[model samples]
Target chain A: MEPLLSCENVSFSYENTAVIKNLSFHVNSGDYLCIVGENGSGKSTLTKGLLGLKAPAEGKIIRGSDLHGNEIGYLPQQNPAQKDFPASVFEVVLSGRLNSRRFRPFYSKEDKKIARENLKKLGIEDLIKRSYRDLSGGQQQRVLLARALCAGSKLLFLDEPVTGLDPIVTEEMYKLILELNRKEKITIIMVSHDIKASVLYATHILHLNFDKSFFGRTEDYIKSPMGKYFFSE
Target chain B: MFNFAEMFQYSFMLRALIGGILISLCAALLGVSLVLKRYSMIGDGLSHVGFGALAIGSAANFSPLEFSIPIVILSAFFLLRISENSKIKGDAAIALISTSALAIGITAASLSGVNTDIDNYLFGSILSLSRSDLVICIIVFIVVMILFILFYNKIFAVTFDESFAKANGTRVGIYNMLIALLTALTIVIGMKLMGTLLISSLIIFPAIISMRICRRFKTVIIMSSIVSVVGFFAGLVISYNRSTPAGASVVLVNLAMLIVFYVIGTVSDKIKAKKFLKQ
Candidate 1:
């Protein structure tokens, strides 16, 4: 089967300044690909490229025809601007279905069912009528994850999803992501600042830095020199 | 003491009430998204642009809405683009455009010597709404209402998170332009009732007031509509009774409603906190 996503020699930039240079990767169906990098390491930019929010300066990004734009789910990092965002959990999740339908004034019953199902999957079904901002950080992440699931179950891209989460919540979020990958067989591309956590959950690892990077199976990544340096000390 | 039935008998008063209600409803509906997106000031800026366009139209002896609607829409699009592409962002860009348009409008009004009409545009004279203005107000209201309903979810998505909406294949730019155009038209029509100086209150005060008491997007929108219509109606009545400026009275009514809602929100929070503590 063709890969779900493939980026061949892709270079990305902002304002003519290159952030990602000649990066290449492919994601098969059900693959849990974790992108590990330091701050400002182009992880978010790479995902933005794949999402078509930003066009690559060089090379090609191939998303399967069935998996373009609104067909791919995304969970961006938390921000203060959305702190007081006035939305019910139901409304937030239902918006994810906007990409699936065309020219409809409101959501269909099928969309509502899908939203409800995703909320249940994330164990947030009870929050459907609750205010999104009233929830705790973990609940908000779950709500967002449910929304992403509503967009597309075939692929998910999460950018530092647990950045501001507590350790226990982080572990739970990772478990939830793992469940989606393992049980639902969803493809995941997660940008993570925690190398150890990436090694723990990822089947494939793509390490990015200013100058050089590594891309391979998690086992090989663990034994690699840079990985040795990271894991040993 | 005001006689509501007697006030309704006057044709001008009827026009003012109808036009004011329609304008308020439209502005309130669109206000939720604008407030959420931090583009509330865009309404203020675009209204200033409308003032300039109106001045030119009055001086040129043309229909003001014809000139102002398109011009304000263009300026709104320009503001959106500048904020997106240029280093000068949100509030700063609005202030720059707003002051420039205000200055140009005032200067043009002075040169043209159309002082009375300009004053009507500046501070509003609801009692002076022409039949044509009423007709235009109704048509604009219908268009805005229909477009807002059809694209409600899309607008909600865009307002909540533009990047996420884009990633999800919603054309962020097109929807943004749609919002700008709708808001611009609403502002143009609304300037007649609230004037250029105070019209943004029509687009802003309701959202803030509703947000005080409502937590959900749809609830906030619904509440805002109620607040805006009621406030506009009450303000019209007050202005008619006291012979005050319709625009200023409407703004004051809205401000009063905001205070009421703020108190309600505070009280509710206190009660909830007490309940939680008892538990």
Candidate 2:
């Protein structure tokens, strides 16, 4: 199958220091690939480059064979701005519906209907009118995920998606991701710091160790000596 | 050249004064989102762009508002697009567009030999506004007020988070572009009374003051409008007393309010801390 996204020898630097070097990888349709690394290991930087939020100083990112903005949705780690912004949840979700078509002509009531359906699907339709800033971390994460889903995206990108959740909620979050992947055949690429927990949910793993990488099936990696060295289990 | 009393006595000055009040109301209303989103620079930058466009419009024998309106809108749109890509910091992009437009405008005015009227654009002439300018200002002010009332939810949503907005299917780009267009309109119409250099003060100063004093979003907006209108009245009175420019005096009055609010917020915090120790 044609890969959705391919990065060949992708590299980036900040002033004199290199953050990512000669990093090359690919993601395919219906693949839930979780990237694991320590802080400053370039996980977030890699995702940012993929989303076109940042420009890599060197290397190339070939997209749409795997995913594009229209086909890819992202849930950023921190929405520090959303705290002071006074917008309702309903309005927040509607913004995801953008990039569908320009000039709209007349908004299909159908799209609005789908947005509502997505909110309900995330089990937070009751919080639809509340200020986005008021929600708890878990709820906000769910809301943001729903918003990402509203884009009709076939692939989802989540960065540190379970950072502040309780164990049960984290379990539920993983369950939800699995459900989406299983039911909708949607591809998910996530940058997760939780090495052990994420292993349960991820189908494939892209393990980055500064200048080198281990890319293959997650189960195989768990049995590999490198995984034991890194995860120590 | 209208005389001071003649300017005061004529219905036109009265209309301009009232027009300034209305336009300033729109500025204060929009300022909440602008300040909170840290896009007060968007207003400031676009207003400067409008100033340049206004100068060229007058020098080239075209309608200043006509030339200014589109260019201001385009700059606002560009700012929004740049913001989404996040290639450069939003503040940096705002500064780049803001200064470039101002430079272009200065060059255009110099080349056209219209330096004499530049002061009117930079430091608005309250005594000489035309009847048509007054009417258009009022119309633009009303249109701005109505759009805010109608689209407050969508505007609030996108300003808070563009991606979250896009994910929810709210036409994030269109709404963002629309906001830029609205901001450009406010700046263009407002330039007639407040001038380019000082008008953004009407949006930002009120917000800075309100955010310092008010706790809730509703309270913040109300306080901003109140602070602004009061500054207008106080400035007009001082301008009359000092025989100075009304627009410039108004800006000084805004600066004064900022100082007062900063002191009050600081003192209040000190008082609360002292009470906590006593308890």
| Top candidate by lDDT | 1
TM-score of each: 0.96, 0.66
Docking outcome class, model 2: incorrect
DockQ (C-alpha based) per candidate is: 0.81, 0.15
Clashing pairs in 1: A70-B168
| Local accuracy by lDDT, each model | 0.89, 0.77
Counting clashing residue pairs in each candidate, in order, gives: 1, 16
Q: Show the lowest summed lDDT stretch of 10 residues, model 1 chain A.
A: A63-72
Q: After superposition, how far is residue B138 of candidate 2 from its true place, in Å?
A: 2.3
Residue A28 lDDT, candidate 1, scale 0-100 = 93
Maximum-TM-score candidate: 1
